[model samples]
Target: MLNHYSLWKYLIVILVFTTGVIYTLPSLYGDNPTIYITQYITEENHQTLDNILLSQIKKILENETITHKSISLQTNKILIQFFCEKDQLKAYQKLLTIFINKYQIFLCTTPAAPYWLSVIKAKPIKLGLDLCGGIYFVIHVNTEVILNKLQEQYIDTVKATLFEKKIPYIKIYKIKNHGIEINFKNSNYRNKSIIPLSKINHGLVIHRIEDNKLHIIFSEIKKHEICERAVQQNSTILYHRIHQLGITEPLVQRHGIDRIIIELPGIQDIKKVKKILSTTASLEFRLVNSAISDFDINNNLIPEDSEIKLTNNGYLVPLYKQIILSGNYIVNSNTSLDEYNRPQVNITLDKIGSTIISNFTKNNIGKTIATLFVEYKDSGKKDSKGHPLLIKHEKIINIATIQSQLGNSFRIVGISNLNEARHLSLLLRMGTLITPVHIEEERIIGPMLGKKNITQGFTACTLGILTSICFMVLWYRYFGLIASIALIANLILMISTMSIIPGMVLTMPSIAGIILTLSVAIDANVLINERIKEELKQGKPVQYAIYTGYRKAFTSIVDANITTIITSIILYLIGTGPIKGFAITTIIGVGTSMFTSIIGTRAVVNLVYGKKNVNKLSI
Candidate 1:
């Protein structure tokens, strides 16, 4: 009984090892090359893929003699799984060429794990960008646009304040470089307006420009604060959007004063990813200017406070400049079908937006309202400082008459297709970018390089493990073999834990951590074996020596592992990117190694040499 384990202890060890193997089995299976097809939403056209489109794709593949595993329809998209990467690439090229304007295509990979394993949600450990290959982007946020917007907002504020204080002005407009200029009828009115404007202390610098004008500009400190805030806000928004895409371990961080660096590991949809990241789209609800007839619009009689925008059907409609609601107030949005089975976006607004919409709808019972869709896009032209210029696009997506008082929840019709509706809903729900961003640099890491890195990492891990096994066996014989087995179990348990945990990514540094863990496990076994040898040399009996060796070695093993676990914790807390990846594996590996090296090896040793008749030990 000295070295024997109880029934419950044996069962616990068996259960843990079996569970580790079961979870590790999923990683042995490979991934299938696949193609994902969705509607390419554009300003002029949006169309979802249907059964007809699926048939067309199938026909095209058959005609080209491209072998495909299966073709199926998914939510808002179509998926085609192929047996190999060659066929996947060929099919992607063929489909893209034929449906260039109608659909967006992406080359991707999905798990080929069996149905049973998938049912249990078993998955392989995620690979990092360096190992799995993905798209890397360097984005430049346009801080100047934010400044311009702030200045425009301040212009309204100044106008309201001066008017309320009974100050007269001839005209107020933005200056050529920065800030705003207000021209007064005379010097006295401008001087009188200065005091009221000074009360709005939002970092505004009010200067008397000549006798009858005042020039207002943001102070240097205020401009810097605005730029920093915009960059930080954009970074946060990008993080949310990337996570919504279901990408794990994406890197979204600020690089320079106005630039963001993003690394999306294992992502292959370049076009869709770019659209989601760079497109600054928002919605504005404005009341329709019903007084402006079409005849007057055609003759260029648009009002000063109203602008004419074209609808989706190519008809021009006049809408008031005042916005009743903006996308910023939207808390949630989803895609749904309307009464006529047309695609629509269901929206839920915050309290303030709800109040604004309710008040407006209550006052104008029969008045018409227009939904203005706005986007800022790169114009492919750079400014003097080499930054891309942005073009603001606005269109009336929908115009509807008020049937009743509206509140927090409503649906907008006139979306071209389901895909478009989904895209709009995703953007609105994730929130819009504060300013337009352009891709300053982009790099695509091919799967070939990724495969090479993975191969190298696998080779390194296997070599390290083999070396550790051979050394342990040659030194301690039978006891060394038990330690080797425990070492292997430690590796399995570590990998399984990584797979089970969310957001654990395997990188080159993680591989190094695994190798180090194997050494640590071997060290623990060596300490126990040496202790047994020492006890036997001191003339202790065989069973007593074995029990005493394990008992004496437990404290040293725990102390060393505890120190390592603490160090790993500190690394994880202070590190970023690759360092974090390494730290995560080290932490998990150290924990598993402690269990295998002490508890697991002991279980096996007790079964092998825990008898009263034993007189000598192999180790």
Candidate 2:
């Protein structure tokens, strides 16, 4: 019942809507390639690194004024764009390395820039470990140890408070299954202690006294809280560590209540990363023995703690602070080569801890302080002294006067390599330099796998579209062939859409989106084909069937696609990354398909059937 003219009209509409081809020429030759580079960073080095990248980009743009340029910056991300010629891709790649290599930048290249335009805005390409192999790590978390540490803090606090209140009780220690046991000499104090102890809630579940001892049981709710805290602590630790390591786009997130995820792209030094992540940089400060001379203090009086044992070099080997400031007061820290070309940590203090630090420095201004012992985690390698050592210690105090002069901020001078200095900064930032904690879990992906996966995925997608078109035309006749053409157009439009959108990444998931769009475009043709068959069966005139079929089917077509549009919107809003790409393409495809099926397809059909007489159903 459909006419040749009407069918031609629908075909054109579909082609225009889906392909953005406008004509056949642009469809094949419009594509071009480009490359991007991401630079590594530390709190201390990001500014210098960013400036270098910006300067290089500015120089390039000065020579060539590329239209449709864009730039954006966030807390830890940067994006830029320009129209690029395919031949210039190699030059761009070299320019990126030359400008950003010193800042530890990683490079990425794409045959097309899809993340700059609005129609099909591509996201920033996420470089997986397989395609851009980087620092791979496996951190085994000591959860039991972390929980015990948490419990210990609460117990210590309660003990200190009871002592201050003169509420004398026998020794208190942690019991099995996460409870505290107190040996009280007086029954009266034991009953009174329960009410006072109820206030000590550091994520602990306090149970009533059982079997002549106080039983503490951490319920599921409490356990979950503890796990969450551990994850937060782990995330913070990894963030600080990666920040210090100067890895850009470091993915650090909570995996489960008990685990964490950290991905540092482009970090190839496994040993260095392992060493930095493994070391617990515990920093402590203790008052000097004013009674002894600097020489005597250095020569004798060993620290009791095994982690801070003294050495035999006529100077105290290692000593920890008895009671000094914690590293949490350090809001920011960075590493730099000193005047002597040795690595040093330059730290900045937050306001809450500044008062204490300012007062400490003011009081110790002119004093020739004795050995301020420093400890370093041995890299598990042999030292020059040929000892099977676990840790290293230094008792030098050349910087005590320097520390006193810096007010709230201070510097730790004298370290071997840039890696060591960075490690020191990570330790301080992770809060392990002030406390004790260990890595819980880790995973790493390399660039090779990413490239393989992406290539295979794209190949499969192309094959799928070709096969789909072959089947559609073979099964549905002339109308099916028209639909297939439109579907191809739809794909071009989607690609071009992405090229125009900023921050859009043409990832593996986005290929899936293109397939979804193809389905939607074909579905519109199916609707029209079915409508034409119904009119033909009803014995309507060819021209009447053609007009009526499209007019009557128009409402259903619009309604169906509109409902799908709403769903796609919701999906786009809630989904992350890949899912969002699918939703965007699907929604756009549906809208475009509807117009082409109703209008363009009708025109083509009318043109074909306008003067024909004895019509046999072909579409």
lDDT of each: 0.85, 0.56
Best by TM-score: 1
lDDT of 1 by residue, 1-619 (tens): 7999998998999999999998988888877788877654332345656898889889999999999988998766788889998999899889889877776677777677787998888887777777878899999999988898777778777877887998989988899656899999999999999889999876889999889999999899988898999899889888877655444467787886999989887677777788768869989999999999989899999865578998888998998777778887888898888889998999999999999999889999998999999999778888999988889998888899998999999999988887778778867866778888888899888778889989998898899889999998999999999999999999999989998997677888998888888777789999999999999999999999989999999999999989998998899888876788888888898889989988999999888877658987777
Candidate 2, residues 1-619, lDDT tens digits: the string is 3344444555666555544543222323322322333333322333333555566665665656443245433333344434554334444555555654333332323223233232343323444454445554534443564466556656666676677667886677778766677766666776666766776664555554643345555666876766666657756876776665445556665544454556666455454455556555455444444444446455655432212333223444333333345555667778788788887888777786778767765776664333233444445554363422344455443224324444667777655466656755654654553223344344555556765876786687688778878877887888777777667656666655554444344556666766666666677777777787788889986667666777777788888888989998999988865677678767766765665556556555666676677456576
Specify the highest-lDDT model's number.
Answer: 1
Clashes of each: 0, 75
Which residue segments of model 2 deviate by more than 4 Å? 1-124, 127-138, 207-220, 236-253, 262-269, 272-279, 282-329, 335-344, 349-423, 426-452, 471-482, 489-521, 532-619
**Global CA lDDT of candidate 1, please?**
0.85
